[model samples]
Target: MKKQRYALIIIDMQNDFVLPDSPACVAGALATVAQIQKILETCRRIKWPVIHVIREYRADGSDIEITRLPEFREKKYCVPGTAGCEIVAALKPASDEYIIVKKRFSAFMNTELDIILRRLEIENIVICGTQYPHCIRATVYDGVSYGYNVTLITDATAAQTPEIASANTRDIRDIGVECVSTFYFVNNIAVH
Candidate 1:
């Protein structure tokens, strides 16, 4: 087997999602910024790939998921060419890092993420992002289903409420997916 390479997959930490008082907000999202940024710094230090998975939609909302299409048509959370679509300032992608735009919850759904990861020869994916029950969970499940070693950084992800976040992380842990805290991952995985 080939050597196992890894990448840091940051999902949907755009202005619309993480910034406080945005049109739509996940209350716990903003709290994760510091941890995510710290992990990004480690990835940069190690020269590991950082794949930023964002969400962008057309003005007419043609590309949005059905569940979110109404909101998109009305408010346009992450429309292309808009400030909302851009990644949060604190966790900005460097010139060398990659950005993957997806219209759905899962970064892998209808996106080139798999192809890019394959091309980069990434075998282990460490994920951290907003809204634990939705985007983070979906991406983690998809990564595991695709046979990649998936790790979810619990402290680096959040949901609208502490209860929701706890439930989601418990469910995620109940599954076979590896779940770790930001401190544990940074201490143990950064050198690999």
Candidate 2:
């Protein structure tokens, strides 16, 4: 079988999740910025599709789930036209790159992500970004359900703590996803 085309899916690396001063900030989210940037540069050099998945909720909280509605309203996270919703400075998508706005954890949830990926003829999804337990894991599960090969860039995806990141990586790997560090992916790009 031939190696399938890959698209780098950077999930929820938005200002609200990554910046320390933002209300929805995950404790270690910003740590993965450089790693994401590194892998993204490699993807650009190789002409791979880069899809940036972001979370943007309505100010009225109608777009969010019942469980998260209260916190989202209180935190005012990722509201439209707000700085919190913007992609963080270092990892902003290029004008031509695909930027998918999602209301839920999985990028495929109520979004055109699957359609876009299909149109681009992508099979292997190289995923990296914030809060491994939620967004990253959800997207990975959906990617598998959609029958695409999934590679989790472990070091480039952060959680609240190192242990949390490690445990989630292990769980995702146990399910047959390729779990690797940003360095591993970058160094092996020549073969990819």
Candidate number of the best lDDT: 2
For candidate 2, lDDT tens digit of each residue in 1-192?
Answer: 866799999999999999998888998889899999999899988889999999888899998978898897677888989998999999988988999988888999899999999998888999999888999999999999999999998889989998998899889999999998888899984257
How does each model score on TM-score? 0.96, 0.96
Segments in model 2 whose C-alpha atoms lie over 4 Å from true places = 1-3
Model 1: pairs clashing at backbone N, Cα or C within 3 Å:
none
- How far residue 128's Cα lies from its native spot in candidate 2, in Å, is 0.5
Model 1 spans with C-alpha error above 4 angstroms:
none
Candidate 1, residues 1-192: lDDT per residue as tens digits? 666799999999999998887866789999999999889998899889999999888888777789887776667688778887789999989999999988788999999999999999999999999878899999998998998998999889979998998888888878788889889888998777
* Distance from true location, Cα of 132 in model 2, Å: 0.9
Span of ten consecutive residues with least summed lDDT in model 2: 183-192
